[model samples]
Target: MAGRVLRPVGVITETARRLSGANLHERIGLKAPPGELKRLADTFDGMLDRMENLVGAQRRFAANAAHELRTPLAVQRAAAEIGLAGDPPPEKVARIRTRLIGVADSSEHLIESLLLLAVSEEGLEHTSPVDLAALAATELAAAEPGAGPAGPPQDPTVVRGLAPLTVAGDGTLLGHLVRNLLANAVRHNRPGGRLELSTSADGVLRVSNTGPVIDPADVPRLLEPFRRSAERRHTAGEGAGLGLSIVASIARAHGARLAAEANPGPEGGLTVRVRFPLPEGPTPAPDSIRLPRN
Candidate 1:
């Protein structure tokens, strides 16, 4: 009888000692009778469940980052090899130079985004008041002059409902969060679509745009790094595909909730809302909250 109860306890400790990324799939799976030992076993297995998820996510992130980096590097190599071969003409050389510069810029952007995502996930190191309304207005104005994301149609009719809404967080990350929301609005919108921006004292910042129809089921996964719609609405040449992902990360760092939904009517787009926590305490982290598609 002494060995019986102690056996499961020993198994639990051994499992934990040997647990690693490679062995996260393993579990003690203690089959002992109901009691303290069995409960402890269940608890240990539950911890492994959470650990498996976290480790899996980190692995996926690293793989995605590698793939994102490889594309730009490949483009640069191709431009160098093909464009400079056999002493190409002056015009051709100029085109190659421009292309290389553009590729370099895109690579830089991707690297910065990857680093920012990591930092945001690690939580904020500094906290201050960040005005969502002001940031929204600034980004919208920047997007209005055809500075919107690449490959989008004519500028959308932007309507603003700005109010002085400030939240406590890292100001720089908050600014990026706002910029990404506007950029996503424009990038996914149709020609002559509407981009609506609104903020209120409740610490809510809302952005809606008209674009291609998105599946309700796909809204949640859009928050994943490098994730894109199966419809291929945004291609590899488009932005780094981190816009919504970064927004999600920043919101998480600020202890806010981020949600997105498909817009109504024939001109379909997305409506994303970020609700910041009151200064009293951090809101619980919301990994995949989204609005019902209409």
Candidate 2:
């Protein structure tokens, strides 16, 4: 019979280590009375339960917020339409239209944030087979006119995906993620700055923009809710800063990796790289083949 010899971990009790796991060294192995050890274990379980409850509450709040905003936006938009049609002075109508636009924009932002949170929290409900290259092209096309370079437009760059290039994730959330990245780039860029977006076969999508340099220290903080750089805070059309955060959260939930870095340019700015999880195995057969024309 082989007798187990447990090495004493600093500040740990021999009995507790045996109880937790023979091969384990943990803070919970601290010397304590038998009753106290049981109490500590109980406390740990209680904390985990509390954490789960808190997460549930947050999800409910997101769902509720999304549900609540839809009605108000509809009502506000209708009222604005009526106001526009009626006999209001040009000056007054202009003011009214501007204020209404602000309201509508605010409401829309709120709804979008809530919906993004809800979809990410719910887990895989709104997902479908998505082509990152196609999505990026579509998103770029849909951006506001005069957003990027002017004159005769250049053709969009495309990266070939290995397979159906499909991943199971919410299409809306993904689109929002792409849109936010593009919008952020365009809004913060220097005049005539370059924007590049590409998707790879290895399940990575990258968006890069040329703009003023963001401080290295600001990268992590940039994703926090309502946190924006001082430079961007005063900028026109600045968002709540949930855009990148939402992208990060959704990436995490989908078991993907989200990375940020400074892009290479005369005036460096932020570049976001998101690596989505590839479905196990190779690209679909039809998608993988290069056909010969008849």
Best-fitting candidate, measured by lDDT?
A: 1
The sequence of per-residue lDDT tens digits that candidate 1 reaches over residues 1-294 is 999658887898888899877989998888867999889889988988999988998898888788888877888999999879997999999999998998888889889998898888899888988777887788777766365354345667888899898889988898899898887887777777898999989889898989888888889888888886553343544587788999999999999999899876788889999999866666656876676899
Question: Over the stretch 1-294, how does candidate 2's per-residue lDDT look in tens digits?
Answer: 122222223223443434332322233433444565456655654654565556665565565455446655776777678777668889978887777777677777766785676667666655567777787778877874453354325322323222335676777778888888877776666655567777777788888777777777788877654455553352236655566777777787777889998765467878888888877766568878888999
Best by the TM-score measure: 1
| Model 1 residue 215 distance off true place after TM-score fit, in angstroms | 1.6
Instruction: Report the Cα lDDT for candidate 2.
Output: 0.66
Residue pairs with backbone atoms closer than 3 Å in model 1 (clashes): 211-268
Off by over 4 Å in 1: 32-34, 145-153, 230-237, 280-294
Per-prediction TM-score = 0.86, 0.61
C-alpha RMSD (angstroms) for model 1 = 8.9
